[model samples]
Target: MQRFRLADLAPAPWRNGGGVTREIARGALDGATDWDWRLSVARIAHDGPFSTFSGVDRVATLVDGAVRLESATQTQAWTTPGEAHGFAGETAFTARLDGGGARFFNVMVRRGRLVATVVAHRTSGVLAPAQDVQHGLLVLHGRFAVETPAGTERLEAEDGLLWAGARPALRATLDTPTGCLVEVRLSAPAQTDGAA
Candidate 1:
């Protein structure tokens, strides 16, 4: 398992003045440009439109301040911590900050190439073993413990663990009821994408 820290990630500024995106992990085929999926946390420093990703599908969770997300189909206001929302990456989406600024977690998957899911854990729990799957565990806020064959991992806010290839039999538990942990599970299509 590989651990990643938000503070340790390099900030990749957006071409426009929206904010910066710090990539946590990405799965590629042959090259970097051929990535089929990516997980990252982005800070919305200003209001702006999102870049279209053509064949990609994305899930966004509001992890910070207030913001409004508007798309051609619908508009949603995130006034507080809320559930994750999924949308077509090709859709023309725009964001408007409600107050100071906002930050969010994003999971993007190439349509037909891969399948991905996200679950927010608010209390202590055990995650049953999953076979032939890749997993990403992110502690959005609060103290948590991840138990695995490798050993127990202690994580704090913005800390994460990303693993590829073999799926581990593991369990995660929040230190308190006030904690939020996000789990992302990914699988490839039967057609394959060279390697995960």
Candidate 2:
């Protein structure tokens, strides 16, 4: 298990070099967010044009402030941290801020290769049954404790924990009102022997 603090997150320019993103963790240590196995965390601060990523499945959640996102088919309004939006990273879209600016939490994986979900739970609750894939939890708000078969540890916003190999037992409880959670479940790759 690893812990990340938003206050400690480092921001960098987006892959497209348009805005900025905070890469929390990736691959083995976390999860890879590339053609093979892509997974990453980022935040957006400005409202401008939409950036496109090829062949990547992505989920973006509103952490702070309000953001309006538009796609070819429809437009989405993410007003609170609990609200999450899923899309094809390759799709064209733009982010329009309602005010000064907004902060977002994002996760991405290879398209068609894996499935992911983003959800917000109350201060005290347990995740429903999750099978077939690995689980990753990213705390979006407040300080909380994650109790798994391994043990219990405190997690602040931006902190993450991974339960891989097989489905593991887990639960979370927040100590504050600003608490939110983002859950990710990714499929494992099939093994194949080299050509004979």
User: Using TM-score as the measure, which candidate wins?
Assistant: 1
In the range 1-196, model 1's lDDT, one tens digit per residue, is: 8998999999999888789999998887656578888899999998889767999988888788988889878997766553688888888879889878898898999898777888888888887666545788888888899998989999999999988867767778778669888888887766737786
- List clashing residue pairs in candidate 2: 27-31, 27-32, 32-37, 32-38, 32-39, 33-38, 33-39, 34-38
Model 2 lDDT tens row, 14-92: 7655466666655532354444344455555576677777987888777778888887787988898768888888778
What would the C-alpha RMSD of candidate 2 be, to one decimal place? 4.8
Model 1: what TM-score? 0.90
Worst 10 residues of 2 by lDDT: 28-37
Give the distance in Å from residue 82's predicted Cα in candidate 1 to where it truly belongs.
5.7
Cα-based TM-score, every candidate: 0.90, 0.80
**lDDT, candidate 2, residue 148?**
76
Top model by lDDT, which number? 1
138: Cα error in model 2, Å: 1.8
**Model 1 bad stretches (over 4 Å):** 30-33, 189-196
